[model samples]
Target chain A: MVPVLLISFIPLVRGIYIGFTDYELGGQISFSGLENYRIMLQDRFFWRSMGVGFLWTTVVTALQISLGLILALLLNQGLRWTSLYSVLMLVPWAMPPIVRGLMWRQIYSPDTGALNLILTQMGLIDAPINWLTSFEWAIPAIIVAGVWGEIPKAALFFLAGLKTIPGSLYEAAELDGASAFRQFRHITLPMMKPIMAAVVSLSFMWNFNAFGLIWILTQGGPGGLTRLPMLAAYEEAFRYGYVGYAAAIGNVMVIIISLFLFFYLRVQLKERTS
Target chain B: MQRLISWILYYKGFIIAGLLAVLIISVYIAGEMAIRLESDEIQTGPLRFLSLAWQEEAVAVVQEITQDWNQAHPEQQVELIQGTWNAVHDYLITGFETGDIPDIFHYESAVIVDFALRGYLADLAPYISDEMRDDILDVNWASVTRPTGAVMGIPFLAESSIILYNLDLINEAGVIAPTNEDPWTWDDLHIAAKKLTKDRDGDGVIDQWGTAMGLRNSANILMNQSIAFGGSFFYYDEQGDIEVRVSKPEKELIGNLARMLFVDKTMSPSGVGKSGAEMIPGFLAGNYAMVVGIGSWARQQVVENAAEGFNWAVMPPLKAVTQNMGVNTQTLSIPRSCKRTAIAMEFIQFLLSSENTTRLAASDWMLPTRQSSLEDPRLQADSTGWKVVTANAQFLSTGPWVGLPGYIEWKSRVANPIFQEFFSQRISLDEAAERIESESNSVLARYQVRGLKW
Candidate 1:
C-alpha cells in the first residue's frame, strides 16, 4: 500500500500540481495560476485535436462494435469450423499495436501498398490512392486499421455475453413461430445491451487515448488532419518542451473522459433501476 | 493473565501498525546500505563515456578507439555506453535531471547551444589545445561555440546536403550533367526535373518522378535556400548584434518550392509527411530519378538498398544566387555534471585525434571535421564521393537560426506545417511566407523576453 501510494499517487498529485504552474523541462518552475489553461482554451490546435479525438472515438467504437457483433454471432452458431474461426479472429488483437500500425502503414502506402494493388487488380479504381498522404483519406485509413485491431477484443466480449444468454430463451422464441431475424431482434439484441454498453464505453476510452497506432501510421500528418488530442499533448510535452501546458492538456482529457464515463454509468444505473 | 490478554487484544490494531512501521524503516535502511555499497563499487571504476554511435561500423570504430585509450592509461579506464541517435537526447536530458549524466556524450551540433545554455555542458575551450582548434574546420568549430564565445563541444564529423541523381536517367532525359565545378542553378534543375518526370507506361499518370524533395528538414533547407538567394533569417552583425531578417529572398524561395511541389509536380507526391531518411526507399524503388537534400552519410544506405542495375552519382548542391550548403556537425561534449572532466576531455581528444577520426570517417563514409583527416588519401580518392562532399563543405554555413533557443519550436510548429500546407495547396505561398515570418518572430520574441541567448 505504501509503495502504491508513493509510486502512483505521488506522481498523479505532482502532475496535477505541475499543470497549474509554468514548468518546462530544464527550466525554472513557478506557479502561473490558470495561465496554461487559458492558453489551451485559445489554442486552435487543442480544439481541433479534441474534435478529431471525438470523431475518431465515435467512428472506431461504432465500427468495432458492429463488426464484433457480427463475428460473435457467427462464431456462436455452432458451425463446423467455429473453433478455427475464433483463433483466426484473435490474430489481429494478439499482434502488438505498433507492429500492426507499421504493417498498415505499408499497406496504405501510395506507390507500393497492398491496398492500392488490390483495388487496381479488382478494377475498383484507375489510379492508386494516396491513402496515408491525402487529407481526406488519412483519418479514414487510420480508422480502418484501428478497427481491424480492435474488433477481436470486442468480439470476445460479445462472445462471452452470448454464452450467458440462455439457449432456452431462443428455443422458446423459435416455438413461438418467430423467424431468425425476429429471434435475434427480440432475444439477442435485448440480451446483449449490457455487454454492448460495457464494450462501447471501454472502446471509447481506449480509442480516445490511442497513440501508438496512429503515431506509427501518420505521426499526425497531412497538415495535422489526424492530429488527435493525445498526439497534441505529446508534441507539447516532448517536442515543444511545454511540460506544464502538456500537463494541463492531459488533466483536461481526464476530466473529459470522466464526464463521459459518468453520464454513461448514470444511464446504465438508471436502466438497471428501472 | 486473562485480563491482560483481553487488554492486548483490544489494542491489536495499533500494535500491528507499529510493527509495520518498524518493518518499513528497517527495509529502507537495508536498501540505502545496499545502494551505498553498490555506488562505492562503481566509484572505484573507470570513467563512463556514452555515445550515440549504434551503427555497426561506427560502433566498431568507437570500440577500437576506447580500447586503445584504455590500454594506454590502465588506471583511467573508459566504459563506453553505446546508444542510438534517436534515444540519446531523451537519455541525456533524463540523465541530467536525475544527476546521472554521463561524463561524455556525443550529440548533434544543433542542440549544443540548447544544452550549453541550460548549464549542462562544460566549456571545452580551456581544455582544447590551440593546435587542435586550428585543425578543426572553421564552420565546424563555429557550430559548437555558444553565442557567448564559449566552446561547449568538440566536433567529430560534419555533413551537408547534396543532390544524388541517376546518370542514366539524366542522360536519357537529355539534361546536362551537373558537376562540382559547375553545378546547375535552381531554374536549370527545375527544367531538368520537368523533363525527367515521365509516364513511361503511358497510363496518363506519372509512374516515375523527377526528384524527391524531403520535407523533414524543410526549415534548414529553406534557410539554406534563403542564403543561396542572398537573404538570411538570422545573422551576426559587426557589433555582434543577432539580427532577425526574414525578407524577400526567403519568401521567393518558398514560392518556388510551392510551385515545384504543387504546380510543377515534378517531385514525388509521396514525399509528403516523410522525413529525408524515410524517402530513401522510394528512391531505391526507382520511383524517383533524383533525390535532393540527401545527407552525405546516407550514401552507404542508398548503395546497399538500391535494386540491381541501379547506378547513382553525387552532384554539388543546387545554386540559386550563391553556392552555399547547410552543414550539420556531430559533436561530443563533457557535461558540467561530470566528475572526471579532465580525463573525459583527454579521452575526447584521443577519440577525435587525426588517426582515429580518419578511421571512423573512412569506415562510415562521413566527412571528418579535422583538416588532416579531411585531407587523407582515402577521403581524397575520386571514387569515395568525399571529393564532392569536401568541395561542397567549402561553401558550408550553419543555416541561420539553427542555434536559437526557440528554433526547434519554430521549425516543428511554424515552418514545417506551413511548408506542408503550402505543398498540399491548402495555403498559398504568400500566406505561408507571412505566417512563417510572423510565427517565427513570435517565437523569437518569447525567447528574448525570457532573456535566452538562442
Candidate 2:
C-alpha cells in the first residue's frame, strides 16, 4: 500500500499541483497562480474541444446503452445459437482499442475500403463517401466505431443486471393478463433502472475520456471536428510543450467528471436507502 | 542430529517450503550468472543506440552493420534499440526526462535544434574529423551546426520531395512526361492533371484521379510550395528575433491548393484526410496518375507495393516561381546524458562511414549525405530514380518547419487546422493566412518568452 501510494498517488497530486505553475517540458518551472486556467478559459479551441467531448460522450453512451439493452433482452430469450451469438458479440470488446480504431480506419477509407466496396456493390450510392475526411461525417463515423466497440461491455453489464431480476415477477405479471410490453415496462424496467443509470453514467465517463480510438482514427482532423478535450490536452502537453497548461485542462476534466459521478452516486444512495 | 531430524519431521511443511525457496533462489542466481557470462563472452557494453529505423530493410541493414561492428570490436559491442519513427520522439523525450536516454540515438533533423536547445544533446563538433567535415553535404552540415558553430549531430540520410508518376497513365493520356532536366511548372502540372483525369465507365463520375496530395504532412508540403513561390513563413531580424510572414504569397499558395482540391477536382477526394499510407494503395491501384510531394524514400515503397508490371517514373520537384524541394535529413546524435560519449561518438562514426551509409541509403532508397557515398554508382544509377533525386538535391532547402523551437506546435496546432479548414472549404484562403499568422505569432511569442529566438 505504501509503495503504491508513493508510485501513483504522489505523481497524481504533483500533477494537480503543476496546474498552477508555468512548467514547460525541459524548461524552468515557475508558479503563476491561475494563469493556466485563465488562458484555458479564453482559448476558443479548448471550449470547442469541450463541446466535442460532450457530444461524443453523450451520443456514444446513448447508442451503446440502447444497443446493449436490446441485445441483452434478445440473448435472455434462450434462442438457438445463443452461446455462439454471445461469444461473437464479445469479439469487438475483446479487441484492443488501437487495433479496433485501425481496423475501422481501413474500413472507412474512401478508396478500396470494405465499406465503400459494399456500399457501391449494393447500389446505395453512385460514388464513394468520404467517411473520415468530410467535416460533416467524420465525427459520426468515429461515434459509430466507438459504439460498436463499447456495446459488448455495456451488454455484459446489462446481462448481469437482467439475471438478478426475479423471473417470478414477469411470470406473475403475464398471468395477470399483462402483455410482453407491459410486463417489461412494469417489472423489468423498474428493476433495471438502478443498473441502467450506473451503466450509462460509467459509459459516459469512459467515452468522455476516450483517446486512443479517436487518436488512431482521424487524429481529430479534417478541421478539428473530432478534437476532444483529451486530444487537445495531449497536443498542449507533448506537441506544444505546455505541460502546466495541459495539466490544468486535465484537472478541469476531472472536476467535470467528478460532478457527474457525484450525481450518480447520489442517485445510487437514494435507491439504496429507499 | 537426531533432535534436529525429529524437529524437521514435526514441521515437514515448513521444511519443504524452505527447501523450495532455496532451490528457486539458487536457480535464479545461476541463470543470472549464465546470462552475465554470455554477455561477458561478447563484451556487450560499449554504446547503446536507439534508432528510429524500424522498416524491415532498414532494420536488416542496421543489424548487419551492428554484427560487423561486434565482430570487429569484440571487446566492445553495441546495443541497438529500435522503434518506429512515429513513436521515437516521445520515447526520446521520455527517456531524457527519466534519465534513461541511450548513448546514441537517431532523430529527424526538424527537432534536433529543439533538443539541442534543451541541452539534451552534446556538442559533436570536436569529434568530427576534417575528412568527415568535407564529405558531408554543406546543407546537411549546416542543419546540425548551431549558430555558435557547434555541430550537435551527424547527418546519416537525406531525402527530398519528388513526384512519382504512373508512366502508363502518362502514355495513355499523351501528356509529356516531366524529366529531371525540365520539370513541370505549377501551370503545366495543372494542365497535365486535367488531361490525365478520366472517367473510364463514363458514368459522370471520375474513376481515376490525376494526382493526390496527402494531408498528413500538408503543412510542410505547403511550406515547400510557398518557398518555391518566393515566400517565407518567417525571417530573422538583425537582432536575431523571428518574425511571422504568412501574408500574400502564403495566401496565394493556399488558394492554388484549394483550387486543385475543391475547384479543379483533379486530385483525389481523399486528399483532405488520407495519410500517405492510405493514399499509397490507391496510387498502386491506378486510381491516381501521380502522387506529388512524396519523399525520395518512397521509391522503395513504390517498388514493393506497386502492382506487378506497373510502370513508374520519378520527376524532379515541381516549380512555381522557382524550383525548390523540401529536404528532410535523418541524423544521429549523442545525448549529454550518455556516460560513454567517446564510445558513442565512435559508434556513430562507424555507422556513418561511407560504406555503411551507402548500404543504408541503398536499402531505404534515401539519398546519402556523404559526398563519397553520393559518388557511388549504385546511388547515381538511373534505374533506381537516383538520377532525378540527385539532380533535385541541388535545389534542396530545408523548409521553414525546421530549427524552430515551437515548430511542432505551430505546424500541428495552428497551421494544420487552418490548412485543413481551407482544404475543406470551411474557410477562405485569406482567412486561413490571417489566422495562421496570428496563431503562429502567438506560439512564437511563448517561445520567445523562454528566450528562444531565430
Candidate 3:
C-alpha cells in the first residue's frame, strides 16, 4: 500500500516541482520562479477554460445525476423490462472515451451527419447549424456529447444505491399517508444521500477532466469557446513544449477540483449532522 | 510462496507482462541498432528519410528516386518512411527527444518556421556548394529560408494558388474567356460571380454559383484575395521581430472580398450543404463555375474532368496581385540529431541532380526546385494540365505565410477562428482584426519563440 501510494505521489511531487521550474522536455531547465504561475493568472484562455471546466462539470454532473436518479427510481419500482432497459443503456458507458468522442464527432458533423439530416427533414431547423463551430453552440454541443456517454454510468451507480434502499421504507412512508412525491422526498432522498454524494463527486471529478470529447468535437475551437484546462495543458506541454507551464495548468486543475470537493464535503457534513 | 504469488496476482498481470514485453522489445531493437551502428563505422549505409507522403502514389514516386539512388551508388542506399501529416510531428518530436531523428525529413513551409525557431532543423547555409545554392531560384528559396536569415531547408516541391474556372460554364453564360494575355480583375471577377450565380430550376434558390470557397479553413484564400487588392500579411523590420504593417486598404479588401463569398452568397457557405473536400465534385457538376485552388487539385479534378469533355482553364490573380501567391512549399531538411547527415546530404544532392529531377518531374507534377530542371523537355512534352502547372510555376509566389516562428499554429488557431467568425457574420471586420492581432500576439508572447525579418 505504501509503495503504491508513494509511486503515484512521486509523479505528483515531481510535477509540482517541475511546474515551478523552467522545464522544457529534452531541453534545459532553469528556475523560472513564479513566471509560469504569473502568466497563468493573466492568460484569458486559461481563465476561459477554467470557466468552461466549471460549467461543464456543474451541468454534466447535475444532468447525469438527476436523470440517472429519476430513471433508477422508476426502475426500482420493479417495472416491466427494467433489466433489459438497464442493460441496454449501459452500452454507452461501456464504450471507450475515444470511441464515444469519435461517434459524437460524426453525429455532429455539419455535412451529411445523421443528426442534421434527420433534423432538417423533420423541419426542426431551416439550416444545418455548425454545432461544433459556432461559439454559442460549441459548449452545449460538447456538453451533450459528454452527457450522452456519462448518463449511463450515473444510472448504474444510482441503480446500485437503489438496490440497497430497503423496499419496506417506501411501504412504511406510504402507510403514513405520504403522497408519492412526498414519499420519494422523505424515503428515497434520505436513503440515497450517501450514494448521491458519491455519484456527484465522482461525476464532478470525471467531467472536470473530460478531454477526449471536447478535443474530438471542437478541438477548443470557434475562438476558444470549448477550450478546457486539460486541452490547454496538453497544448502547452506537447504542442508548445512548455512543460512547466503545462504542469502549472495541471496543478491549477487540482486546486479547482479540491475546492469542488471541499464544498461537496461541507454539504455532506451538514446533511449528516442534520 | 503463496503470499508472493498472491501479490503478483493482485497486479492483474500488468506489471510482469509490461516489464517482460519491454525487455524483449528493447533487446530486439538494441540488436537492430547494434548492426546499424556497426555498419556505420565501415560504410555509409542506407540513408533513411521521413516524409509526410501517406498516399500510395506519393510514396511510390519517392521510392522510385531512392531506388535510382541505390542503383547509382551501391555503397550508399536510401530509404524513406512515409507517414501522414498529423503523425509526422509526433514521429519527428519523439525522434528528436530520444536523439533518433531521421537523416532527412520533409516539412511544409509554415512548420519549417516553427522547427527552425526551436533549433530542431539544421542550418543548411554551411552546406551546399556556392554554385548549387546560386542555382536555386530566389522565389523557391524564399519558401524554405527563414526570414531571420537562416537557410534551414532545401525546397523540394511547391504549389501556388490558381484561379480554376470552368470554361464551358463561362461560354454558356455568353461571357467570352478573359483574354489569356490579359486576365480579369477583381471587379470583373465580382461582376462575373454575380452574373454566373443563377436559380437554374427557378426554385428561388441558388443552383449554379460563381465560385465555391470553403469558409471553414479559408484564411489563406481570403488572404490571397486581400493580397490581390494590394494588401500585406506578415513582414518584419531589421530588428527581426514582427512589425504590424497590415494596411487599412488591405484589411478592407480582405473583409469586403470575404463578404463577397460569404454574405453576398457568391460562394457556397462554409459547409454549403457539403464538405470542403466535396467542393471539386460540386464544381464539376456545374454547381460552381470557378474555385480558387492549387495546381494539384486543378490538375486532378479540373483537367481530369476534361476527358469527359469538361475543359477548364487557369486564370492568374487580378491586378495588384500580379501572380498566383499563397502558401505552398514541401521541403526537405536534416534534423540536428541526425547521425547520417553526410549520407543524407549526398542523397539530397543526388536528388537535385538534373537526371533525377527530370525523372521526378516526368512522374509527378511537383514544381521542380532546381533551375536546370525547370527547362526539362519532358515537362513541356507532358499533357496540357502538366504544362499549366509548369507555366504557373514561375509566377507562383509563396510567402506572407512564413513570417513567424509559430506561424502555422497562428494560422490554424488564431486566424482560422477569426476567419470563421467573419464568414459566419458573427463579428465585424474591425473586431475580427483586433482579435486576430491580440490572440496572435498573446500566443507569440506565451511561447516566446523567435522569428527572423526578411
The 10-residue segment of model 2 chain B with minimum total lDDT is: B38-47
Of the pair 2 and 3, which is ahead by lDDT? 2
Model 2 regions lying over 4 Å from their true place = A175-177, B1-44, B237-240, B399-401
In model 3, how well does chain A match by TM-score?
0.91
> Model 1, B1-454: lDDT tens per residue?
9998888899999987888788778877997888678556555678888877755787898999999999999999999998787677668877777666778888878777777767788888889977789999988888888767788889878877778787788888888878887889888878988998999989798978988877744776777667778777776779855555557777767766666777899888667656777778877777788888777777777767777777778888778888876667889998886767887899999898888888888777678888888788878765546788767768877676666777777776777777777776777766776777666666666566667674
Root-mean-square deviation of each candidate, in angstroms? 3.1, 6.2, 5.8
Evaluated at residue B260, the lDDT of candidate 3 is 69
* Superior candidate under TM-score, 1 versus 2: 1
Recovered share of real interface contacts in candidate 1: 0.36
Where is the poorest 10-residue window by lDDT in model 3 chain A?
Answer: A1-10
Q: What are the TM values for chain B, all candidates?
A: 0.90, 0.88, 0.82
CA shift at B226, candidate 1, in angstroms?
2.3
* Model 1 chain B worst lDDT run, 10 consecutive residues: B240-249
- Model 2 Cα lDDT, one tens digit per residue, A188-269: 8899999898898889889999999999988888677899999999878776678899999999998988887987898799
TM-score of chain A of each: 0.93, 0.96, 0.91
Clashing pairs in model 1?
Answer: none
Worst 10 residues of 2 chain A by lDDT: A1-10
Residue pairs of candidate 3 with colliding backbone atoms: B148-B452
For candidate 1 chain A, which ten residues in a row score worst on lDDT?
Answer: A1-10
Q: Give Cα distance to truth, residue B247, candidate 3, Å.
A: 1.7
Relative to the true structure, how large is the alpha-carbon lDDT of every model? 0.81, 0.82, 0.71
